[model samples]
Target: MSTQKKAIVFLADGAEEMEFTISVDVLRRAKINVTVVGVSLKNDYATCSRGVKIIPDVKLERNTFKAEDYDALIVPGGAGGAKTLAEHETIQKLVMEFYEKKKIIAFVCAGTLVAKAAGVPHKHKVTSYPAGVREQLVNVYNYSEDRVVVDENVITSRGPGTTFLFALTIVENLIDVETSNTLRKEMLTHENL
Candidate 1:
């Protein structure tokens, strides 16, 4: 039997391109199976924050995706995308289900706001985009200014610049530190970052 880990990335309109793309890229490089799910009911593609349109591998719907099927759930950030994710009832329920299943729930930049809306306990330490976004989550979570913060199965990171580390961190959690380190070296990310 194959032991490869599977992850699902939720994509909405205005998602941060780098966060979405890099997370998928790095996770695939680590040999993880990544399924991109479009949160939009209107189309199969999500128009990113910078106008990059990407067609997801699947559309999130009842009986289509489940928390038990994947090792992690990833949410990328953009102002509009985060708002959409935070407001979507199905997405919120999925977040809770992932939490209940003890699966990794990873968010980047403003995407961290979705955790607050989804009723994730506020005691966990987390970080987000440091400007206006941080203020909203400060009173709710044990907010930090660190580039990446991992509190148990929940992982959060800053903005686009921290995406590589954020994705690598997820890889570490799903696989192991040794695999993550090897990818870092192979990608020449070890010397650059």
Candidate 2:
């Protein structure tokens, strides 16, 4: 066995650039094998919310994922991207598979809606942007105002402002506290964070 950790980040048009890029950057910094996947039918580049065009490392195909091949799934949120993700059955299945396997499933901003749609159980503690909105969340999970909330294998964070914290938390989960802290110090990931 290679013993290398692997993660997949799914991207749709209008995904929040900061959330997707920062989290990927942090994970790569920790030596994780991170794959950026485009969700379009062609599996091509996705235009972000800020108009940043990103070419994915791969394209996701329905019924083709072997969930056991990866250690984590990450979803970055924008209004349009999250809506698209929430409506995709394949993405939903992938999310649920990761959850069922007890692997890390991380979401940022409205991406939390994707988890809700996938029926990923939460321990009544999760966070997302526009904190008061709970309409999308089911009765099983309660929303939190914290920057990032980790309930077992499910990790959630607020908007772009907290992307660093979100990414660092993921690093801690996949690697260790010492590595996460060292990266935090090296990156100087904001004074308040």
- Candidate 2: 10-residue stretch with minimal lDDT: 131-140
Per-residue accuracy of model 1 over 1-193 as CA lDDT, tens digit each: 2598999998899999999999999999999999988886456688899999999987776347788889999999999899999999989999989988999999999999999899999989999999879999999999899999999999999999999999999999999999899989988889866
Q: Model 1 compared with the native: what TM-score?
A: 0.96
Number of the top-ranking candidate, with TM-score as the measure: 1
Candidate-wise lDDT, in order: 0.92, 0.86
Ten-residue stretch with the least lDDT total in model 1: 57-66
Off by over 4 Å in 1: none
lDDT of 2 by residue, 46-158 (tens): 88899898998877763367679999999999887888888999899999999999999999999999998898865647888874435566355877778999989999998
